[model samples]
Target: MNKIIWLFPFVLSTLYVSAQKKTDRKTLSNLQMHVAYLASDKLEGRRTGTPGEQLAAAYIAGQMKDIGLTPMGEEGFLQTFTVKEGREPAADTKMSIGDQILTPGTQFIPLPFSAASSAKGEVIPNVNEPDNIWLVNVSEMDITNPHESMANQYLKEAKEAQQAGATAVVFYNSKETAAEVAEWLDQNPAPIPVPAVWVNDAVSKKLMADDAEGFKINLQVAFKPTKRTGTNVIGYIDNKAEKTIILGAHYDHLGYGEDHNGLGTATKEIYNGADDNASGTAALLEIARLLKASKLRGNNYAIVAFSGEELGLFGSKYFTEHSQIALSQANFMINMDMVGRLTAEKGLQIGGIGTSPAWNTILPAVAPKELKLSYDSAGVGPSDHTSFYRKNIPVLFFFTGTHSDYHKPTDDAGKLNYDGALSVVKLVYDIIDKANGMDKLTFSKTREPQMGTNARFSVTLGIMPDYTFDKGGVRIDGVTDGRPASKAGMAAGDVIVQMGSLPVTNLEAYMQALGTFKKGDQTDVKVKRGNAEKVFQVQF
Candidate 1:
């Protein structure tokens, strides 16, 4: 009996040691494997609702299954959702104003946001009648002013035209306005509330100056809206505890270098968002493995690999709203995003710091010495964590900061700091370890980050500057329709080397130079396109 008792203690010790090994530092090889496949070109950027994303979802589900986690999704490990996909305009679209047939590219272009509709009516100046087509001139409107004001004006005018029962509205603008509108269409390529067309200055002049009896307009705008499918992978460990802890990571990224990509130069390159999210997804898998091997106390665990995050927070939003376990039973949530490029000196940026009081004390206490930390009290930012915060749940967001390759095709697996990511994951594990047996985390409201909800700039160049461009000049990725940059003949791939007399070396310089210009100001903007330096006149 004495010998048996001694052997019982030895057996217990062996089991404990084995468990410790499973929960210890995650293997670098495993991280590499997950990242390699997730960010591989074969996956084609894993865009939400695409076959690539479906493949990634299947892989995550397989990993969770291997980790011995119970499926919590509607279909085994999958929580599927539907989204509306917009179709491109048909090439055979036709439009005519009076006796003149307008060319699609040169004289006028149908806004991509227009729904499929055909209308023929008398062309009237402004919106006086509900049955007529309205024409509004925006040549005098200052393009350099804040977009909110200009956008507000467009909204106000469109609402009036709609209220007047106008079937369509034609905007008369300069070449700049045409370019600005083109850029806007690139970013918001979906059906708008009203049908609209943008016509050049010459067309506007002919409409206003010519005899009114024959002034009629006809247009055939085309678009098709279809349903798209998306999936979210949910895994769980039922500890039968009162509250559940959640861990999540977004796995979706931009595909084929669309409007979101900060194109260094215009070319069809796949945006492999390895660091943007593959790193976070890989970390999620590693953490799930560790948690499966660890013994929990008084709480269940749920891990979600979210899709449709690039389009918005569709996966997290759906899960929180339709979770099998009530959201009220959620103890807290932690999110990992862009954790691959962790710079030791810069450390990690932990958002939603003020969401829980315990975090203020607990985070500092358990933070590893090897990891540097920056805290943002805001619970609201541009990520999946915001969805949980809206539910009054305490949340923590881990980010490795932004870089030149962010949202660009160059963001590949080779650029990731693997050791740095390991440190970050370890820190997250320690935080969880401390909170294992604690009471449900208390929720607190945090001040929203400035960049969260507002555009702080005094003026805009009417162009979308590539936020990830590290080059000498501010690279124009998308020019807004009817904006000054468009008026200045600035196109995508054009680098603004000089704004007025100011030498623009980078994004900051460009913004600063733009601030110096006010509404109605005119200046020469210099751009580097190919090997040639071209200067164009811009009216702010």
Candidate 2:
């Protein structure tokens, strides 16, 4: 009887220990496999539509199949879509102002959003006209400093000029304002209603100084829009529940060190976004494995590996718009982004806590002692979760926060905290457990955070500034196709060393430099293309 009792406990303990070792091995091995492959050099940073991205999609789809999850995408496990990637200037372009012939890429740049058409007419300052080209001088406006709201005004005025029957609009402003206008153009895929040009202060003054009467302007610009393909891998675990839970992670990263590479380093080097997404992606796969193996399948699970997220939630937005499974049945969504870098102290940052009343309550209860939860109420941030939140669906975003290696070639798999990632996966599993089979979560709208603003000013630089650049100077990730920066031949990867007479050492300095200019002003912008320094004149 004593042997029976002793041996029974020993046998049970041995089996439990063996099972634990097996689990530990599986967890680490599975996570490592996913992150290693997804963030490996062979994947080539997995930019949307690229061969690397296709490979990633195939791998994810294969994994979904292995998990016994049914395909929840348009085609098997893939939901393919086309998006306007970017636009390039087409030939047959011309611009002239009376006797002065404006050279393309030197005197004026066409905004990417500008329509491909020809327009010629007398130039008049802020005059609403159908046949006349309107001249907008920033000096004439109430702009006194750099401000985010003022940046919108530039686009608003451009739309107004188009609506007022103006054939084109010419803006004269400071380098800062021109940068802002350029940025706005690059961001909005919609074409501008009319031709637009941003001339330097010198050009503005020269034009304004001349007689308004018989002042003719002629311009022609053609933009060739580029299309890029991306895929969203979706798999479903249906428990016949009316309300479903969604788990998502972006698998795309900056490809071949494009303009979006925050550090502005390495033009062609692969940016293997290991922690930026590979970690999150790995977590998703691990969670799926757990869910598949678990007995508790309370609610339906729709797990997605989104693509084109680096470009702006393209996959998530597309999935939400054309979901194979009705999004109306989605109770809530959990997004894992940049969750690979979780530290013992920093733990995890859970954004979108205010997105549902249930999150704040359920999070603490489910979170383990190992994790310290930092909460953020705002649902709208720079990730795919924002796409679902916009659809009135509650969301929870898991992140480990930014790191020194963010958006750079240095974000490789070797640097990921695998153990931390596994914990996050467990946390997600618990979160699902807490909400599964429950009544649909009440979606609450949280106020959106300020869009790209750290300082208030009147003037703006028109290019989309890469905020994550770890180096000196403000890095320009994207230039509006037809705005001042584009006209000035300034492009992505150009580091704005100086704007006008002020040094732009960082984003704050860049903003400070912008506040010094008003409308109808012009300034010289110095940029470092590589080791070479180049100067371009920008008008606001």
Candidate 3:
């Protein structure tokens, strides 16, 4: 009897494998076609807000349309969002003292916080006359505070000059002590109302040489914020159900390493990101197809191909915040990121298991016996699913482990494991099939990861620094419980401006500051929360 029972189960498993093989041929073909085009050189790595990204969006929308899925975006399967690239001085920006013209970038450059306005007035030193350009010599200014940025000191001087009735402030340093002032421009800075300019050492020497005779100054400090539009492709399958399940994948990658997020040393070559996300995106389309044609109709499906994910979850965050569909009716969210490199030995990684209690039971039951699975309970990860999880929705994230080619130009279409991607697609389909008639999953909070974790550092604040925040300092995206940041009362959205005696000007500066500290150290951390700056005592 036992032998007969085992043979019956073996025969059923064989039948299932045969049926899956028959269907996988077409699925694999679709995966190959989608990946080849999306990861092709023609798409230019599909960097968000670029022409390549637009082409990828259009292609994804066309695929959704061909699948007979309903458009769920604001504009017929296309949802647009503005992405702030950075700021740059305008082409017409110019500065002149008498007849001598100062080059915009070489001789003189507008401060990052300078107002984009023109100022014409007589230049005079040590004269704080109203409606006149004041030349401030910062060569002898006190800069003893190690925690204060030199740029901030210049800004303070400008603010003082403005308060003293100066129309515009021109800063020049004659001493070598302030030689570092040349690197003062912040890539992303908050603008001040008053116009400010910093002249190079050569220009300063020239100005000082002609200081005896006051000259009429013509200054124009104009800056334009670099921005571009990123589109998210959305498609839906309306099953006439009470709840909708969201499936998402990012289709954007680093284009020629322009974003500086690529791991490869070569920036000229395209970081195709086929395994990073093209695989996930292709898998999403296949999952959408399976769900659309499946008999399960207990819940609706919203499949989204997100852009600007490589730029810090911009697309997914925007979608969750400004969703056209009712978020209150959102049953759950599933995200696929870097799902193309799965191997039998490397296995599959499934995150957000603790997000919903149902995941513990449902995942194991639907997971294929041939596939090894690892689980991460945290709902807050470095992916799009975190956006939905933040909205109090249950979430699941699928990933095939990173390889040597991750975030490199070699992560191309040829490196993808199409069979592995197919297995993931089928696994997700089975999960959806099993949960078709179940009640809405319950959300449960899990431990957050200590983002910004570096092996060189011994201490961590236990906060996820927002990679998209360019304006100065490191912004906290999330705070882990029982960590230094959370214990110190730091919360998400707070920008860490100063750590101990070091100025946290940017993410790099923050990491460097962390290296200065050891475990079991206590220090005062300053953060800008909303319009106010607050200090917290952190114990690390």
Structural RMSD, model 3: 10.4
Model 2, which residues run further than 4 Å from truth? 90-223, 450-540
Kindly list the per-residue Cα lDDT of model 3 for residues 263-317, writing each as its tens digit: 5655389878898799999999999988887898999999999998988899999
Worst 10 residues of 2 by lDDT: 176-185
Estimate, for each residue in 1-540, the C-alpha lDDT of model 2 and write its tens digit: 998998998999999999977886798889999999999899998988899999999999999999899998889999999855555556666788888887655466676557778888875554556767887775566544444455455667778778877788777754543334434444554678687767766676676674655577888887655667899999999888788889999998887855343443445788899997989998998898888887666678899999988877889999998997888888899999988887776668888999999887788889898677777787887899999999999999998867657767788888988888878888898888877656789999997643255544444455777644648998886665455777789988899989877888877677777776766579999999999999999876
Q: Write the per-residue lDDT of candidate 1 for residues 36-93, one digit (tens) a residue.
A: 9999998888888888888899999999999999999999999998744534446766
List ranges where model 1 is wrong by over 4 Å.
1-26, 82-109, 112-219, 261-263, 450-540
The Cα local distance difference test for each model comes to 0.78, 0.80, 0.84
Weakest 10 consecutive residues of candidate 3 by summed lDDT:
174-183
Q: lDDT, candidate 3, residue 408?
A: 74
Measured by lDDT, the strongest candidate is: 3
TM-scores for the candidates: 0.67, 0.65, 0.70
Candidate 1 weakest lDDT stretch, 10 residues: 449-458
Query: Pairing residues by index, what is the TM-score of model 3?
Result: 0.70
